[model samples]
Target chain A: MSNTTALPISALHERVEAIFRKAGLNAIQSGALARVITAGERDACKSHGIYRIEGTLRTVKAGKVKPDAVPELVLQEGSAIVRVNAKCGFANPAFELGVPALADRARACGLAALVINDCTHFSALWPEVEALTEQGLAGLVMCPSYSTVAPTGGNKPLLGTNPIAFGWPRMGKSPYVFDFATSVAARGEIELHRRAGKPLPEGWAIDADGNPTTDPEAALAGAMLPFGGHKGSAIGTMVELLAGIMIGDLTSPEVLEYLGTTTLAPPHGELILAFSPQAFSAGRPGDPFARAETLFEQIAGQGARLPSQRRYAARARSEAEGIVLTAAEIEQLDRLLALGLDAVS
Target chain B: MSNTTALPISALHERVEAIFRKAGLNAIQSGALARVITAGERDACKSHGIYRIEGTLRTVKAGKVKPDAVPELVLQEGSAIVRVNAKCGFANPAFELGVPALADRARACGLAALVINDCTHFSALWPEVEALTEQGLAGLVMCPSYSTVAPTGGNKPLLGTNPIAFGWPRMGKSPYVFDFATSVAARGEIELHRRAGKPLPEGWAIDADGNPTTDPEAALAGAMLPFGGHKGSAIGTMVELLAGIMIGDLTSPEVLEYLGTTTLAPPHGELILAFSPQAFSAGRPGDPFARAETLFEQIAGQGARLPSQRRYAARARSEAEGIVLTAAEIEQLDRLLALGLDAVS
Candidate 1:
């Protein structure tokens, strides 16, 4: 692959599929994993895209995740709340099978929840949330990962850089979506800055001794701070309670301690909630999408850039002009492809 | 009432109850409203405590809110999602009526939502969420007020402080709960700082020209900043979508624009979501409360204070030692009690 050569989404997806297939994943698993990674790439999320492939492959080979594992329905709360046990497999496939059921159930019940437990969730949560939003429903997703952040005014890392995602449906336009980690700076982002030899902004992290520092290296060696201080830490705790306790999976810190850095894609948990506007808003005369669009316009009129606006802009630009990875990145991809995982090549 | 006198919770409740009863509320309504206000005062929440009595009186006097109005069930989606129309009255009464019903329904359905519309929510949201929490359910409450905070990167006020409250149930312990505004500093806090001749904190609010300022007066005249910039703004938007659009009530900016500083409450909306732990977590061997306690301990071990820990400490001290109101607060209470509307007084 040439550094200047633009790869279509289809091309990247195929390459990723080939890699997964080489790692013994079935077509369904390969396809599901490829779809998320491709979207990450298409949206210029390099950290979650090409950067994750090697780790995922290593996990699959090490038997930390069952490549052939299938998700099973464990419980149902009325017709609205459904729980799926992912059985120590990758989460994307479980979500693929569960989200449609979630949407259909929400349409009938007005609100629905798909609680997925015991899965290794290595991808961004926005794709599943946006899927619900694109179906003209409001979506909210919560997930807790390995512990990496210290609580407010505390030195030890006691919580994950938990991520929460939200999506609102819009008719004839892209759904409004946002996904963010609870930490002031995601560990991956700090690592990225360190790789690029860039100085971090203040208030992002602290030194190993718990003193605030602007050095990304020092912060990574120590612990990341929660965004917005105490408030963000509280939200992170809420995420752990909802996705961990509610779903009957190990909380973030518990997972890290349970695994002890020996595994990848170990059983974690996630929760996806969807709401149907039609069933709830009997008093509204116009479409709910129109109302949501009006609110979006109100913010836009204030000259504020919304999350979806930035994402869509980047996505559109990437889809048309293609993403440009560095020379080193292309070489790394080539090396990964040559690691006995490219039977087709 | 002497300013120097330390008042018991029962005494404060009695006075608040008398004021509400005098203003035409029935015993049930007066009791519910007094309970919340007393909690605020006991917790040292000066912003929502005695300070709000004047505004509540003004709203009642101006006919913006009907003191005698009652909330009635308007819509239900199976047993899980319910909507209540407040008949243009205060929200505390509506929650007082709906929460018991909500808890019952949530236990049956595993999850339930109570949407309140056509109401003036003049008090803190924590009370209603705490109600559901006490019943061994996870509670989430969302309420959007008149626009007072600016969208990130935009100077104009396009969203309210928009507090979202969450509570996690713990058996035989104070349920962990927190309520936070999307804005870094709420409007009422800025007013308090201005009155005390105190400087505003950095990153709290911007001047009229959208420039960051430490002067409380300048920030008060301008728009308040969201707590975590774009992230906070997005959360505020989520609250509006869930509370306003889904509940068929006016969104934040729309409400402020329609009222134009002419009214109090102005027919706001709120959404309360409750989830039953037993229904969601089938695999847990022991009580979910035990797991929750462990998580709380983990944080405490890290020297991180959880929300309920702090609140319960304050509540205990207040109950034992009582609270002392300032001379100005006492005078304001005196005037409020002497108003012509005070029939009970």
Candidate 2:
């Protein structure tokens, strides 16, 4: 009656998975994709939620990502590196297959890295780091996106929005997490501004001639700026070196070249590093977890909020009251399920 | 005939080391301290060069740092963490003692971490990461300073001007490196402004009452803002967690509490992560080093200057023409050597 549907978390996941399956994604791909999408919605991260499904399916239909490919795990024995070849599929399943082994290696070696290659990557990196936090390990995750951001002092786009995410486990509480794009603003932000007939924010972008511009159209035709000026640009470059070239995968410019457009998920790689507190803090005074809580309490005591609190709060709400979707959103979901790959351009 | 004198790199190192030794520093402390200070001068990084010698002696005179303490390395068998307890000494010597083990572990484990605990730290972090680059590895180094920065949305100094430095080895060129304070600017910059009787730029800090202020005096008594707002604040907090709390050492606030003054070096911990590119790129296609050069070339082609080029250029100049010190600098160095621990209050 209210033109909305309240679905339990599982119900929403089932609906999303069913849609991916109908679109010809294998069980592993569909399930992993559905989980991430559902988690996005649960956390109220609308940008990465079910809205990504169409683009994902479009990538599959365009022969950009392999729908039925399975991710392969290469456990480099006696080493701290765990490799996962995504087999041309989405990065979600690849991350899934690698997390357990990564956790094991981290515990045994005290620090470990998981490298996922040949993956069509989507979803916010928080989910990936949160997975490690759930396993009681501190983690860092990073990956390259297609080139859309210009290195500071440069005119053209050469660096990706290259996201970096970090998480620390907290006992009996939600983990401490932060994930962000190195760019001043995400490309989708400019897209929204363009659609809204709005001028972009100052310092967010530069025009075609490498001069600052506020017009979203000019910005789109030009380049986005990295956050924090050169510092952020340097970080974006480091991501290219570490998560891209160091992992033997496509850099952001190469990803853009491969895809030819930004509409579809880009093929690249991911790097995840896990650190064990028990191993790191061994023989040293103070429990790392307890000390971290004190730091968090002091931060809050000073009236500063920790990162990812809003997401965690929304997750709690979603768990209690279910995910409420509007009529239009429900219709879109239904249409996608009904028409499968034919629903997209 | 002139108000300036030029000293070869070796002469400067020997002079700085003699002053430290006269000030009661042991061989390891004097040698390591001299190396970094000379490197700073050689690179034209005036802020960290011979200018920092008085502060070093002041800290030593105040008994905040152990002048003769030895560092002990603890190699956890079968683990990727190589730790060095600085025994209340300077972090430089501790870092030097741990690097070889860290490098070995990184080569063997694909990734490794070096943790330096109980050290009085006062040098720029570029030297730490550069040491790893010298060993043909990619490295990241981070450390917490005394609390001087406010977390975003907080009005008080609840975080440190934590610095993170990263480096990647390059073939036949200077290694790629970037090191920076997470705060909008270093505390020293604000102090310099105070000395010059100048107002700070807007958004750099908040007054004691939690309102924005450009008065350097108010900013110092209040809190410096993190760079890039919440993102940089989060990174600063991460430094506290990983480098301070995770290493079982003092956090920024605790360091402030322990030191009772920001003028002296803070006793805390440092975390250095090393990655062996050969191990990481073993089964992957393309050479990581060569690929990084391509990325660098494109960035430069677009007119973006890579970080640390200026320093590398200065090093080249110093190597050719020696380091030039102004008259005041020469006088201060001679006085510090003459007076030793009595040079400062």
Candidate 3:
């Protein structure tokens, strides 16, 4: 038998959705979660793909997230803010519920913000931003995770690996997009190194005694450092202020305290801002989309790769050739579909 | 003779305003410019203080900026975007003219953006964000300067240093604020290194041929690197897109092409976003400001320094003891006020 089995993207989505539904997730939650996970697999972003299914089930088993959440959208007259209360469910569904209104508000206001509160978040932000680009709008997305990274110059973990993502629409091409954690390295990277018994590169983390260290174990026990020293640290702090407190949601430390462990998905709030290029560039000379092409050309002409190129390329391939899953992955999926929540622990 | 002279902040502002007025700037432009420059000096940020006045006059003398042009505000009913057409003047006055309307719109809409177009921008962004903080709002400001930094993995200068600034209001204290260039090192830092006969730092810049170089002169002839590698580069690129192309203003490369030299200030548009915490945290559990204070205390408890602390400390001293200027600086100010635009080549 072949070591790998190929499945169409739609087929994989159905399987994932089945597993979530079997685990008692509501239709909205299961569908949205499966879609994001399937998109992750299609883009060759394995970290967020099927690998995340177990964690999702574990969180469900632990009762950290509501299995049947019905998100409610709140739209105010003459306001540029679109809000969605997730009712303690997964953030994906809340985001899905809010995006259309967010798009409408952005079109009307030139720029608008979508705030999703009281949600369990565990997916990459790129999908949220990518959705805006699909609607011909530029978008930025941010949210706080569980606290795991230290502010620069601090000895303990107080800041999360708060991720920031940005997307810009292009002319019949993949939108320019980038999503990255403010920390020097993700906690998973350190965890992988610890499992492999490898040492971390310098500057990634500090020891428990507040000294720099290379040992992955010590670094994991201590704290990961913010990227680019003070500059990245400041950006992370801004994320806490804007996406956390400003949104009236739980900050990273609060999420950690609520969950009591890093294994569970974080319950917090997310901020997504959308901008209508047509509205902003209405009186301007050049078409914003065409002008953006020129900028990308200059960047690529000089041999610099645009962000999200790799993921887009993988997406194209996956669409054409189907996503290939290893036999072990197939077995894992089968077990998940068969056992549901009982499969996790 | 004493090497330095102490002057009240108001006195310094008057002297600076007088210099601009003599240089042929309109009353609005001169007054706004003087206030920002004086604020810089009061905070001990010498780079943007009196040191920048000469450059402003140089830009004026070169006919790159309008000295006497008046900025006009353009407001559309029910829109969150408050625009100011700089009328080819300095950005300071345009920003000053739009801030009040911006604040009002933010309060009404929960969030708002102020766009200043067609201006010569040289002053630091902190003052702009700080102005929003003074109104009890959180603010974010960004603008594109001349292209001097290279996109990561690219050999040539294709992006600006692209500074980003953010400020959050605090109760009974200076706002939490940070402003920084996306580049690993500012162009001035490289020029200073060259003047001091010091080699450039590693990872700071690339030679004209695209290879890394520690020689300051070679680096100056080449391109500076973005901080935090690809992440910073993505942010710098985003600035060019949102603050530049999206706003229908000049991008970094376009600014460089228009000016043909980095010595002259770049004329571009700016984007300022203001968010209302009261509107955002309407029915949330804890007070956002108090929660932010908790976050700050946790950071400080771990021995981490908050951004802008030093500047705030200096500001307190300047307010209490008056601002002190070096004798040489005083003489320069006198010469500029006396000679006006004729002082520059």
Candidate 4:
């Protein structure tokens, strides 16, 4: 077991921002990156939080990801569709430009869709979706990555554990957010278990031969299973075509074949949709936000819990008591701090 | 075992059309209904074929579904966003108005989305999607219906076995079409088994208490399972929100609780999205369809067959020879044919 320590949210954000600054990211990029990373930690999404810092930093160091790059609007028409040439690393600029643009279009068209190709990995899609809900729009987002999974009953990895997220604005509470990968388990989870020397749960992964296995090491060397079997496989496959092929990027299988080839580019594609409530019920007198609140209250009254309830609860607790960090993670931070000092030498 | 007979596609279509006409449908509506039904039969999708005729006719007779209603575009903005009232049923007018509207919008916005609410049941969605591909647009469609499925690990049905479909254009061949329900097994499949006096395959359904069962009757009395278990369940749940709740319609629980209420309305919603190749690659500069065809061919050449290959092959055979109907189905049709004579009396 690792020891735990508490740090104020603001303090953690400042520290992260400082590190990014030292790593040569511009002020705006560092600020945005800090905010995204802190939000993930507060939401208890450890897999997408600071755990990704090292990998991101390495990409930056290799000049493979540009922190200062701004995304360009490739196409736009009415309030229905928009396309972005995502020149920056995926997370910050995408949130800065894509979400607001799509929401604006939705406001005008009553429905809007944005497709962004050539974007790097965007962390914890829920934040981006929630941002749309803040603008009183419903959001649905899907991102397809390079293949990290095999089709159900197949021996070779042929798709990514592509993630899909949707957010619906509710009345007085946070929007109902649902975000998950199509795989039985995510690659991060397998890595976490491997690092901790723990076994994986059944149905989470398969070996190279397509036989189930609980060994994390074997799982890393093989493929993650699609959650729910064939249906999950189908969903993941659909995401590949919708977000990848539709965007004119590499399909899932092509991404797999190009994996680990430094000469090959990162897999990329994202689709975001926003909907305005006015389109469906034009003259309903009630405020949509109020109606949303009433509906959530009714469901809660019936003891039917909404998804994202726990995440919000976790955020509240973290705000009150400060964020908790494992001793191992803190040690890694200390190592990074030392690296900062060594860099000056 | 039941005897079966082969009938030419045109004959089957005509017979089905006659039944609809006798049931009070106008010429265009009856023709549309007949074509979709016959197409299902030709593709061996018995569940969505003639088997649905009786239920559909009852809906029309009860005045719950409009027979001659034509969908009207209530809103359109820059060809990127559209709202179709679906004044009649979902399949016919939606195909007639929704696809063309979406394609035009996609051309303007690079992407387009259409929402069709207040529509009646639409049979297999693949054909409608294929229509979009024929217009040189990528199609993604989803429809959520009244509750016919229980949540994973839950007893009460809280969602429809919602289906999703996608179509991608290829050169010199038919478009790649994929359509499937989010359920482990469609309700129609279980109903078919019950009619044939056969046990259902395991893992397809659960009883009222949420325990697995293979009895078709029990499965019907219970709820169908989502495909791939939790992952499929998640997708189905997303569809319920995206196509149903987001459209401001009745949710699954609400529909179930108010099923027999005088104010009850159809609990179904659909979302159709279109993406222009120009949006991603600035049109077919080097033959986009040809490129897509080559990509798929190369993949298949490497033994990676695309989904829906077998279904398309079967459809071709049926068209070339004739559609086959079981003895029970033929008897049902004959009984319906006799109804026309009785109506004249």
Enumerate the chain B TM-scores of all models: 0.92, 0.99, 0.99, 0.85
lDDT of 3 by residue, B156-192 (tens): 9999999999999999999999999999998999999
Question: TM-score for all predictions?
Answer: 0.94, 0.99, 0.99, 0.89
Clashing pairs in 4: A79-A105, A171-A292, A171-A293, A184-A227, A228-B228, A228-B229, A229-B228, B79-B105, B184-B227, B278-B283
Candidate 1 RMSD to the real structure: 2.8
List, residue by residue over B1-345, the lDDT tens digit for candidate 2.
399898999999999999999999999999999999999999999999999998988898898899999999988779999999999999999999999999999999889999999999999999999999999999999999998999999999989999999999998889999999999999999999999999999989999988999999999999999999899999999999999988899999999999899989899999999999998888888999999999999999999999999999999999999999999999999999999998998
List DockQ for all candidates. Answer: 0.65, 0.86, 0.88, 0.37
Candidate 4 local lDDT, B1-345, one digit each (tens):
349888999999999998887877777678878888898898887767897787677666656677777777755434355677766464566556666667777787667777776677657888778888888888888877667777665676766778888888875677877788888887667988999999998899988667789999888878788887655776676676666666655555555564442122344557787877656555212444555665555435534457667778879989888998888888888888768424321
- What is the C-alpha RMSD, rounded to one decimal, of candidate 4? 3.9
- In angstroms, give how far residue A5 of model 2 lies from its true place: 0.7
lDDT for each residue of candidate 3 in A12-46, tens digit (9 for 90 to 100): 99999999999999999999999999999999999
List model 1 lDDT by residue over A1-345, tens digit each.
Answer: 545657777887888887787678777778889999888888877667977887787777766678887888754546467777777888888888887788887887778789887788889888888889888889899988877798898887778989999998887877888999999988877888899999889889888888888888898877898988888999999998988887687788888887677236545889898888887686654566778888888888878877866567778977887766677766666666667344222
Q: Positional deviation of B138 in candidate 4, in angstroms?
A: 1.7
The candidates, ranked best first by DockQ, are 3, 2, 1, 4
Backbone clash pairs in model 4 (N, Cα, C under 3 Å; residues 3+ apart or in different chains), count: 10
Residue B13's lDDT within candidate 3 is 99
Q: Which ten residues in a row have the lowest lDDT in candidate 4 chain B?
A: B258-267
Cα misplacement distance, residue B214 of candidate 3 (Å): 1.8
> Which is the winner by lDDT between candidate 1 and candidate 4?
1
Candidate 4 lDDT over A1-345, as tens digits, reads 348988898988887788777777777667877888888888788866887677667666656567676777754334355677666465466556777777777777677777776666647789888888888888888877666777765756667878888888865677888888888877878988999999999889988766789999898878888887655776677677667766666565655565563222354658787878766445323454555565455445534456787789889988999889998877876665557423321
Pairs that collide, model 2 = none
